[model samples]
Target: MYEKLVELQSSTHEEATQQMVADEEDRRRGLEAAKLQLAEMEEKRNVSLLTPFLKVAIVETNSPAFEAGLRSGYQILQFGTVTSTVLASQGPSALMSATAEGVLLPVWVREEDQGEPRKILVVPHRWEGKGLLGCSFDPIRAK
Candidate 1:
């Protein structure tokens, strides 16, 4: 009878050890999945870093910017010879407003089809629209 009791105890101990091993394996798999998810998020962030700026939210019909072929979802890469990097750093509103009147503001834009940014000359004028440029922009991060 004593021997039978010892044998039962041994079986219980073995079962408990197996359960612990299974639990540890599950934990390891969960941690690995979390790491993979974090890596994917980092990759997306790095890709966005290449083009940092807001996309045009609106392009008023018949406006100068619209006449120049500007459209919504297009990213304004530059506000002239100045790169978006420089303009973005100085504040988009201030730099854009500082442009001299009648000076054809050369701009770089990334359209849907364009592989890289293309230069587009936009002549800002007080037209029948809401804003000076007749367009609205929202930062990518905001989206």
Candidate 2:
């Protein structure tokens, strides 16, 4: 009879241990979900205005945008326009300004797997040194 009691106690202990493991797993999953949520929010908040053909490569450490986040593989899919409601001190307006001063052409472009329409705009504010930002691009012909 004592053996039967001992067996019952062992089974109860095992079940309790299983329950604790499951609880820990549940807590872990919940924490992971929260982390992903925060990252998504940051990403949505981080993007700037969309542009066409804006070079999407990262600026080098010695380059102009190095003090900026301009990490390798990060792109400038957009420019000039605000990406979100909250504007951060670190943003892309400087790049746009430089481009306006004949630094580069401002245009919209997207990369692979983005799953969005791949085009943006650049307002034609006539700056002395800048090239054209018009929609119409044409091929040059030999004379």
Candidate 3:
């Protein structure tokens, strides 16, 4: 009976060791998966001349576009190309002297395809959270 009890204890220890090994393997796989996910997110956040910010104007102050380094009075020659839309303040442009906070402005200005400056409004999906450099810093495609 004593020998049987010892045998049972040995079996339990072996089982525990196997469980520990399995758990460690699971943890390793989970960490690898997390790393892969982070790499994918970084790749997706890349800025390319394809999607997202098609056109970019100059920079401004206290503006989401400005926080994104978008200036004002410049030219959104690229992403603003085709039929993309720019989110500006809408409704009343008044900041104070009103009940509500203010209006949201997102104007959609399109460049005429006719003999113009030949600006390319190419926005890459990768530039999602990237800082907005000057619009003219890119290579303008000649028409």
Candidate 4:
């Protein structure tokens, strides 16, 4: 009877240890999933912060802006570091200063027909036309 009791206690201890390990694994996986979900939420919030402040008035054919997939009626959400707030305070100079020759600038734009915004890299380089971008932009005035 004494030997049997020791054997039962040993078996119970082993089972408890295995259960603890399984619970810990499940907890680790849940933590990882929560972290991923938080990251995705932060990304969406950052993208939402960029509001459309300018609209593309013209995009010359074969130009840098045109080649970068910019088109007329597309709204410019963020040009390099120029966001909606910056555009309101500093105006077009902020955007013009951002476009350095031979440098690739990240531009976030929203299409007129689409609800989501897209990112496009525009390289400011001299083309056959006048300006570096060969595109004209108009400010989106508040209603």
Candidate 5:
């Protein structure tokens, strides 16, 4: 009877160990799936961030905008905190309001040749040109 009891306990322990291993494998697979999903979501968000909202209509020579490497035909993805959503409700004034004198504002832009988006730091201080940026922007119409 003692030997029988020992055998039963050993069998029970083996079964429990196997179940635990299987559960661990399932958990690992679930974690991997969640990671893949999160990566996909991040990729989509990055792509959206690169979408252009406004195009640089003109950039004056020797101006703050030109000094910052802004060029005509470059599409503006984001200017400071101004995005397409803000432009939709607030117009171009939202972008102007985001700028401040002597402050370097980050602007995301894409070239007209469909290149990858790039970031440029622009200061809004007075320049030799008309506007603070010495550049003009035009809204990109949706197709």
Candidate 6:
């Protein structure tokens, strides 16, 4: 009878431990979901406050963009002859079209709020890896 009681107690302890682990996993999943939702909300808020302008998101090492002093977070106002909303809507395709044929396209960059916008020439050239322009961009939206 004592042996039976001991065995039953061990089973109960194992079940309790398993329940604790399951509960922890459930809490972890809930926390992860909450974190993801928060991140999405933050991104939406950031987009809402920004103006409709394209900004460089990345510049690859030793690429033409990098060599031309193009860095991440630089706002691109004009891509060649295109400007404003037109550039915002068709920036990526326009960039590809303008640069794919070894053309030197003029790009206006507003580096700072107090500084004047300056133009830079970009030649889209194929490199060792990834994007042809060696850069990525994000559209800035108005608040």
State, as a TM-score between 0 and 1, how close model 3 is to the true structure: 0.35
lDDT (10s digit) by residue, model 5, range 18-133? 99999999999999999999996774467456557889998999889999999999998888888787888998789768999899998888888775777788987797669788
Task: TM-score each candidate.
Answer: 0.54, 0.36, 0.35, 0.68, 0.64, 0.56
- For residues 1-143, write the lDDT of model 3, one tens digit per residue: 99999999999999999999999999999999999999856633432222222334443344345444344333333232222122223322221211122323232322323222322221222224443322222223333
For model 6, residues 2-103, the per-residue Cα lDDT tens digits are 999999999999999999999999999999999999996774454333333678888988887887778887887666655555556775576556666476
Positional deviation of residue 44's Cα in model 6 after best superposition, in angstroms: 32
Better of 3 and 5 by lDDT: 5
Ranking by TM-score: 4, 5, 6, 1, 2, 3
Separately for all candidates shown, the number of backbone clashes (residues 3 or more apart, or on different chains) is: 0, 10, 28, 0, 0, 3
| Overall lDDT per candidate, in order of appearance | 0.71, 0.44, 0.39, 0.88, 0.85, 0.72
Best-performing candidate as measured by TM-score = 4
Q: Could you give me the TM-score of model 1 versus the true structure? A: 0.54
Better of 4 and 5 by lDDT: 4
Best by lDDT: 4
**Between which residue pairs do clashes occur in model 5?**
none
Give the per-residue lDDT digits (tens) of candidate 4, residues 35-95.
9999967754686567788899999999999999999999988888899898789977998
lDDT of 2 by residue, 1-143 (tens): 99999999999999999999999999999999999999856644444233333334433333333322333333344454432221234444544353553343333334433534333333443433323332222111222
RMSD (CA, angstroms), candidate 1: 16.1
Candidate 4 residues lying further than 4 Å off, grouped into runs, are 1-45
Where does model 1 exceed 4 Å of error? Answer: 1-50, 112-114
In model 5, which runs have C-alpha deviations exceeding 4 angstroms? 1-50
- Residue 31: error of model 6 in Å? 69
Candidates by lDDT, descending order:
4, 5, 6, 1, 2, 3
